[model samples]
Target chain A: MRLGMFFREALRSIRANAAISVAATVTALIAVFILGAFIPSFMYVRSAVSAQTSKVDVDVYISDTASVKQVNALRDKIGTLKTDGQVAEFTYVSKDDALRLMRERLRDPSVLDELPSNPLPAKFNIQPTDPANANAIVAAVKDDAALDPTEGIVYPQTTADRLLTAAKFVQWAGFALIGILLVAAVLLIGNTIRLSIFARRREVEVMRLVGATNWFIRWPFMIEGVICGLVGAVVAVAMLWGIKVGVVDAWASGADTALTKTGSAGGAIAFPLLTVVLVGAGALLGAVGSGITLRRFLRI
Target chain B: MARIDDDIHDAGSTPRAFTLVEVPLETVPADLAVVTPPASEKRRRGDVFRPGPGPMVQFQGVIKRYDGDVRGLDGVSVSIAAGEFVFLVGQSGSGKSTFIRLCIRELRATSGHVIIGGRDLGELKRSKVPYLRRAIGCVFQDFRLLPDRTASENVAYALQVTGHSRQEVNRRVPEILALVGLDGKGDRLPRELSGGEQQRVSIARALVNQPRLLIADEPTGNLDPDTSQGIMDLLTRINRTGTTVLVATHDRDTVDRMQQRVIALHKGRIVRDAEGGYNEDPGDTGEIA
Candidate 1:
């Protein structure tokens, strides 16, 4: 059949079954809407979580008796950890640099200037690639001979552990919610199409008796499904854009919300790409729902 | 009880074995046995079906069993030649519908063969069922027409679905609609037409392809007697054009008036097959035992 013929038939069917068609479209819209809205919010939360975790770092302090060669070896060990993805980066603060940093921090510069021969010890500030990896990084270097015996390494272990747990929860819960919603959407859309097809099953039977091939009969229905999907997706994307502009943008612009404190919520979500993905997903879901539901009816 | 005992004796083990009345070619009236020209020899507008040489439909001990072991058709065998008009007469549960369904390969026989136009329907691939149906026009009691389409579009749909070009569909649609006595009613939807007119539109759609066989399961079941007569007359006229017509009906008066070949089924078995009125003598045909 001609492409135009399929479209004409599909349009005619959609008009004839307007109520069910609308139901199917609305089903797709609701599904796509929820999924689209959740995606950006989840991304924002994940970004904020990572930002908080990025602060947990390992601090290695060296003893004054340690030789330059031992310090150099420790620096090389940190470089190896960086390559292994355990450490994000390491910066060395020599005794003189430490004394200068301390002098800058003290409001009374004369107090720091009274110290004789810079009594501060050198240390290496180590940032782990992941907050949960801070404990591992500290464990890897705490036994090294170049470090001080007493306060050799210091990391906010309790804070990193709690942040890691919270981050894991956020990631898993977000995925579970999206997954459950997706399955529910598929079933709802499929049921609506099933009812629609059931209403017109006699039409299909007559077509089969009149010598129309299965694909010939399937084309118009499939096209109708695809049209519903595309329309629903476009509507969902538009709604999501409205919410982004009206709700999210308004909230982010306000004074010092927790989201704004993280400074990663606004301007970070890709609205254009999200629109494309949501539309594509809507179309795919619509097509699959109707196509599979039509199988049992076509056997006649 | 006697029939059951006889069936067991004849079949040795199966209690439903039936004796089919085979209508010998010589027994058929000379005029009704007229040989139709091969489809390729006389190609005309909308005549796409090419029926191979031999009987148009043959059922060899075909048995159909529904769920719960209820026999729909049991050990039934019959053959219908091309270009003949036959009436299938039976009660509601006498397997008339099952026979028609088997002819279209809509139901498979349990252990027998249903061959159509020299092709075994049992072996016809599932994908090819539509092609098989294309060669056989079918009508029903309800006049199955698309409610949204006009009569002309409904007839055109049969050709359009098979990828016929616009020029072919346009030409054939009007001709077939006119042939079915719906010349000026092409633009009317099914709901706008009377019961008889709706059935005519359905017949138009069915015969638009000019199939080799036409099976009507109670084509006049919903119509008044006068309208039913008109529809039967139309079917007779179509049969005159060399399309084998098989109609299953409960209209005894029409069967008596037509005086066509009648096959009577009782309890899923053919009890009589003879060219006469509805109450023709069963012994005049094949042996029942």
Candidate 2:
């Protein structure tokens, strides 16, 4: 019953002060919309980078003079190589399989037909369970002197290094941008709630005089703020859904870009999860902003 | 100066020894006896006027100093019995508002003790201030009604905030409105009512909780002579029903006409404390007689 009264009072105040209410709701919608748009893109970029890194492996080529028994033994040893308790998997490709793969990748089979013999060597592809452990796996392979007959290992060090740098930059920049925007949203909501409460300070004084406890006087205002936040979040989520379906999907259909490929690979945040996060952030911002603002005005 | 100091000291010592001043029933006006609650219900509620030996309000050498070293109440000591209708009369800047604010615990006294219903306000925690205020009804000159709400809602709000049941609020709002002589005006908004009617609504709001004490700070300051008289009569009737009433007013005519116990202040000091009309003597300085 008390909660009902509080909500009634809050709704009444919201209607009475329409301009301030709209300003606060619109500010919250814009802020939450920006946050919603940024987070999925950030998640998508992170997943795409990690997917590229996971494809990196060390290739151990077998020497032509090495016996089949030696090659099998080296493969067994590479399979046992583990980093952080994660075993490496070895895929042994024969010389014929390598030649076949190269032939398929090449646009013209006539150039490959000019060679006197297949020049490609049989290699074992060593993959770590976790991409972050690739360096440790490579070090272990290099330390194995028993595999001396094998050709030198080939690890894409430059590509790995560049991917790591890009991931770190994106993570830090995403956090900084979200932090600035969240602060701006909080300040705008707080100021609007403060103004709304200031206009009704006389009513608050009367409530206090009539023996209303501090919480009793504060509940309505806080609930009003939460309602504003919830409305903004719902609107922003709807807009985000429209953009995702209309803009992003259309662009993806028209072009085969890297982003589209990543999207097809399921690199984006799930819509349900994104909606929950955006709505939760919006509600939290609204409640906290109004709660803090009421503290200064309602001294009862 | 020495005589004046002695008189102030004498008034300060009266409450310490628990002196009760009995005013005969015939001395009160006959017209103030219209509405009286039944004796059985009054006893069940344990009204403050249960022939108790203790004073309802006690101030022991209270000193309240504002910012910039200004004195709001300067070493003032007085006591009000449980059922007394006392008038706190003074000109502007004379500590009347300060005295009332201290009673409600709105402004803490810088020194000395203010005890209401046998509880020391200084020892009360900040969280308990609301409960303390609940025991005292306060009516202000500006009425302080929420302009957006009807008079009944304004009165029901007081009961609602104190956690009364909705049915109880519905039951009691009209009763209190009737008691305050705003019987049919419950549906009217504050702006639609006259200044006097608004003040009555404020008074009804104050009295809805059946507080032990009612403190009116110039409740009729904005009303004309006739409306002010009606408000004073309502206050007198409310007092006669066993609720202690303290009125601080600049209306010298009403104070003189009521002829209740008047406690007058000048420059934060109590100049006179006695059963009388408003003190008009210019030569008298802090003299009780």
Writing each residue's lDDT as its tens digit, candidate 1 over B1-289 gives 1122222123122111011123343423333222222223323233233456799999999989998888889999999998789999987878899999999888888878898887777776677677778888899999889998899998899988767778777767776777677878999999999999999998988887667799999999999999999899888877766679999997888999999999998778999999987894333333222
* Per-residue lDDT of model 2, residues A133-236, tens digit only: 77777676665433435466787878878888887888899899889989888888989888889889999888878767789888999898889998999999
Q: Which portions of model 1 show Cα errors greater than 4 Å?
A: A61-123, A129-150, A156-177, A253-269, B1-49, B280-289
Most TM-score-accurate candidate: 2
List the candidate 2 regions with Cα displacement exceeding 4 Å: A61-76, A79-124, A140-151, A158-184, A263-267, B1-53, B281-289
- Evaluated at residue A200, the lDDT of candidate 1 is 88
Model 1 Cα RMSD, 1 decimal: 9.4
**TM-scores of the models, in the given order?**
0.81, 0.82
CAPRI-style class, candidate 1: medium
Expressed as tens digits, the lDDT of each residue in A1-300 for candidate 1 is 488998899899899899999999999999999999888888788878878888898889998899999999999999999999999888999888988898888898898766677777889999888887887788888988899777689888998888888888999998999889887877788888888889889889888888777888888888888888889989999998898899878877876687677847452568988988898888888878888888888884
For model 2, residues B1-289, the per-residue Cα lDDT tens digits are 1222222123221121111123244534443232222222212111121112478889999999999888999999999998799999887778999999999888999999987867677876666677667768999999999989999999999878877668777877887788788888999999999999999999999887777789999998999999999999988867766679999998989998989999988878898999979978343445331
What number of clashing residue pairs does each candidate have, in the order they appear? 0, 0
Give the worst 10-residue stretch by lDDT in candidate 1 chain A.
A259-268
The DockQ value obtained for model 1 is 0.57
